[model samples]
Target: MSAQDIARMDTGEIVEYEPVTPMELEFMIRELGARLENAVPVLKELWAARYSAERALIEEKAKAVLRSDARTITEKRAEADLATMTFRRDFDAAKETLHAAEELQKALASRLMGLQNINKVLGHAYGASR
Candidate 1:
């Protein structure tokens, strides 16, 4: 069964029984392909446009959190350094802070990677559909 036949076969009966013309088949394929191709950009645009408000709010929250974290990390690092300066007694505290920072860095990196994967999937869907 051709692409067009499947498409028109809603009730398991071929409606266009006049022998599927080449032009008809091609037209159906192209039309469906175009629709699929256009869907990706449309979806992306929708995602971007729809997320504007939520994204803005998230951004504001993220900025505030980031600022707070920056201050905290700085203070912790300084404290760690000072403690280390006095003696090696505070080595554990300093190491813990460094480890926390590393964990946070890893989380952010993973988030970025996830976004990249989403974009790649969108691209692939767009291409395949087209």
Candidate 2:
């Protein structure tokens, strides 16, 4: 997509992003990085609330499944018993939450790295200008 499109696109919507010019890219990267660096912790808090809500629901369902399995286990160890039907469901949901959070963290980290790299470029740019 075009640079304008890249500028507008959120990280999730990114199809592909690569710098066209080192100097210009550095500027853009620095700007974006600085913004993200400031926002990372806030975004993390948001994610925590979102995922906690989701996990709560999943955990309830998982508990129900566990109770059911506990009641059923002594009679027979069926597919459901070995399957971790309850725990697995909860685990999967939690895993997804964690994975999403980690992705966000990585994105923020990338932005910070970009900012640092751009700062170096900016220093040179100003030096040259002087």
Candidate 3:
């Protein structure tokens, strides 16, 4: 599946990784790395949005304090602000996506290493026979 297809996988869906030949593994690694690099900007934007959410919450509290709003009202407003920070959901989703990409990258590396080690062992066995 393409990277975008992977991204679109539903939570209830389970997809197994099919083993690739060593040559294909190298290309997959490069593709995954590029996807990760491309995601940097999106990650940055998500973080910026999260920070802005924090700032907005802080400003609301500060304004309430300045206006001498009732303590109960201020607390309730904070709770509401937290509940409505929709960007938090987006940011968390983006974070999870990046994490998944990293994990796939690691898996690709591990697969490549295992194949290389197997090749080396076979080479040694053949050399010994010669």
Best by lDDT: 2
Clashes of each: 0, 0, 0
Prediction RMSDs, each to the true structure: 19.3, 5.6, 5.5
Model 1 clash pairs are none
lDDT of each: 0.46, 0.58, 0.55
lDDT, candidate 1, 32-66, per-residue tens: 45544554564455445445544544455444455
Which parts of model 1 have CA positions greater than 4 angstroms off? 1-89
Q: Compared with the true structure, what per-residue lDDT tens digits does model 3 show for residues 52-119?
A: 66666566655545555446876766665565466456556656666665555465456546645665
Q: Identify the runs in model 3 with alpha carbons over 4 angstroms from their true place.
A: 4-15, 69-130
TM-score of each: 0.31, 0.44, 0.50
Candidate 2 lDDT over 1-130, as tens digits, reads 3434333335443324555565656656665556556666866776676666666655565555565635565533444344446555665666666666567557656755765676678689979999
Clash number for candidate 2: 0
Q: What is the lDDT of residue 36 in candidate 3?
A: 52
Poorest stretch of ten by lDDT in candidate 2: 6-15
Q: Is candidate 2 or candidate 3 better by lDDT?
A: 2
What does the lDDT read for residue 65 in candidate 2?
56
Which clashing pairs does model 3 show?
A: none
Write the candidate numbers in order of decreasing lDDT.
2, 3, 1
Best by TM-score: 3
